[model samples]
Target: MFPTRAYSRDAEAIVALRDDLARWQVASGIVQWKPGEVTADQVRDQIAEQQWWLLRDDGAISATVRVLEDDPTIWDDLVAPGTGDALYVHGLMVRRTHRGRGLGGVMLEWVESRVRDAGRTTLRLDCAAANTSLRAYYVGLGFTELGEREFPPPYKTLARFEKPVG
Candidate 1:
């Protein structure tokens, strides 16, 4: 639940989910994530701050994602001081076994509901610019390109995308 619970009761589970996603990303070589890219403390903080969400089925964590209202590293150039208010997505992932099952769409649908409830109009995200397939996947889901940004470290470039949610 994103924006539902303020803090995660099970911090270990959140860390495990992130580590799993990072490991999968590395094994798949489709993303720049390494297993330790996100630390336990960060996961705890994300959960405590209500930015992280977990989807469960049969009482186990099936997927996880993050939503934010601000992302300075990626959106700084495009947003003015008082006008950068939109739902931003980060680290969206389904378990490797659940990847081809359309869970991503379900997560996006959930996000849309949250955005609507918050009276927001846009849901935005950034994907690695080198990841053509990933970019196409989001485009297929009807997210339009806002622009691209060159980052200084870790990430080289990212394509900004947004879809009207409300």
Candidate 2:
């Protein structure tokens, strides 16, 4: 199994990982991670409070994922933010050179385990609605899209997905 660990005192690695992913996404025309999509402080905060995990292989970071207790901003309509059967996922990205290597699925399995241990029965996430390939990818992994959600500040439509855990 690839080594994995919950975020610790290494804030620098967290920032670097996010920056690399964001830059690659923008350069590749994936609007999901455009400028200001995530900030350094946001990464730092996730490292501090949320259940963020880092995966490493051969002494290099391969992927990162954050699992939150709930995501009201995105799923307030379907399930109440703090008291749902689902654990929300955010910031799940595999490094550029590591894509299509099953790292994303591995990270997701880790998330499923974490959520199962916490007594949550589902894992949920939201992706840009326009990103059809991504939505299809998640579906291929057994996640079902609930539907499109509208945001208040007029952000891009987000497609929500859920998969039963444990």
Q: Which stretches of candidate 2 lie over 4 Å from their true place?
A: 6-9
Q: After superposition, how far is residue 122 of candidate 2 from its true place, in Å?
A: 0.7
- TM-score of each predicted structure versus truth: 0.87, 0.88
Tens-digit lDDT track of model 2 for 122-154:
999999888787899999999999999877654
Clashing pairs in 1: none
Residue pairs clashing, model 2: none
**lDDT tens digits by residue: candidate 1, 10-110:** 46776777678777767877674667666767778887788877777676677767888777767878875345457789878787777788888888878
Using lDDT as the measure, the top candidate is 2
lDDT of each: 0.76, 0.80
Model 2 poorest ten-residue lDDT run: 2-11
Q: Residue 2 in candidate 2 has what lDDT?
A: 47
